[model samples]
Target: MLIKRVPSAEAPLDLLLEADPSIDTIKRYLESSICHVATIEGETVGAHVIQPIGDGVYELMNIAVAPAYQGKGIGTKLLEHAVNMSRKLGAQRLELGTGTFGYQLAFYQRAGFRVISVERDHFLTHYDEPIYENGIQHKDRLLLALEF
Candidate 1:
């Protein structure tokens, strides 16, 4: 697998959005942000967006791998790239939000993230439609951070 930065506007965004729809708005807002896609055997399988939030802080906007590719460490490699890229860019901390509970939370925890804050009822109130994954709907957002 290879992770590559894709600068074209038409670069398989549907896959990314399918992983996390909230990112569509973020992608629209951050014009100069960097986006990466992971490919295996010439197929786009995963993607993540990184946006600079000023004050030496960067946000991990979206991190997702294809359903069939989850648990195979593709997300981990992308995360490792994000961490190193942020550090190289002089970021003091990296922040992201995820469902209050689930495999994603544990994935970040395993990747050295720590809970920093929580927005109660964020997912339930912020989104117009319910966000569901594998028969589970996310009701809240938990903010996590890792300082480098």
Candidate 2:
């Protein structure tokens, strides 16, 4: 498998949806962003999108791995690649927001992201449909940051 920046993000829209459920939300972050994809034999298995916020800090806008490929280190590879890419672009830190509780929170924490703040009722205010995982509704967004 190989990981590289994708010229067009159109192809992995489906894969990206696997992580962020809303197309509107995806559009907000995807525009003018850098997109990277992991492919195995030319088939896309995962994708990560990044957008520069300011002051050498970038936002990890979106990252998604095919459901079948989750927990198999593909996401990890994508994240590691994202970090390297960030540093190459002279980034001092990377920021991302995720649910208050989920595998995603654990994953980012493991990757060195620390909780910087929380946006209360973010999902409730933004998403039309409620997002639930492990039978628990996600209402807030935990803003995580990793300073390099």
Q: Where does model 2 exceed 4 Å of error?
A: 8-11
Q: Residue-pair clashes per candidate, as listed?
A: 0, 0
> What TM-score, to 2 decimals, does candidate 1 have?
0.89
Query: In candidate 1, what are the lDDT values of residues 15-89, reduced to their tens digit?
Result: 777657765565674476778889999988988878898899999988778888987988899999999888988
Give RMSD to native, each candidate. 1.9, 1.1
| Model 2 worst lDDT window (10 residues) | 4-13
Error of 2 at 76 (Å): 0.5
- Per-model TM-score, in order, reads 0.89, 0.96
Off by over 4 Å in 1: 22-26, 133-136
**lDDT (C-alpha) at residue 120 in model 1:** 83
Best by TM-score: 2
